[model samples]
Target: MADITTTELRQRLQAGETPHLIDVREPWENEEASIPTAQNIPLGSLPEKLDDLDAWKDEEVIVHCKSGSRSSQAKAYLTQQGFSNVRNLLGGFTEYSAG
Candidate 1:
């Protein structure tokens, strides 16, 4: 799937659509600023947490990080692991919070 812009995500949430969002930043980074509904699973821990995300395998799972880099990696990993609908948040939280 193509990456989603923060604006698009904001619009979806404003429209009352609840999408599954994953924040792949560090615990400290997540604590600093985070979307309450987004689950924080630090990038390094993703391997161990694969089972926790199997439920969302075929679902639209949005992954993000401080910038777009880490989430990009997360998206790639998830996609290779059989997740068909994973999307990286364009610009990550940096863009999301900017708006």
Candidate 2:
């Protein structure tokens, strides 16, 4: 497991890097706010949706949630499930939106 700061993530997104961005927050939270291009995969459903993310197995996957905590858990879970590359967006959407 690894981590990327909000600054780095923003730069990557701006550069058109296509990382598999996973929003692990709940649907309502996502509806209120979200980073552009993020795919909602609420933390609770990630286990059942592994097949949907298979195409991103070889690519870098960046997970994020409301305040970064959930995203950390999501990243660990994905890594344990054999994901080769996973990163938690440090400070998550709250910080991203603020900055």
List residue ranges in candidate 2 displaced over 4 A.
none
Q: Best-fitting candidate, measured by TM-score?
A: 1
- Taking all chains together, each candidate's TM-score versus the true structure is 0.97, 0.94
1-99 in candidate 2: lDDT tens per residue?
Answer: 569999998888899987789999999999998899999999999999999898888779999998889999999999888888999999999889988
lDDT of model 2 at position 1: 53
For model 1, the superposed segments whose C-alpha errors exceed 4 Å read: none
lDDT of each: 0.94, 0.91
lDDT of 2 at 15: 99
User: In terms of lDDT, which candidate is strongest?
Assistant: 1
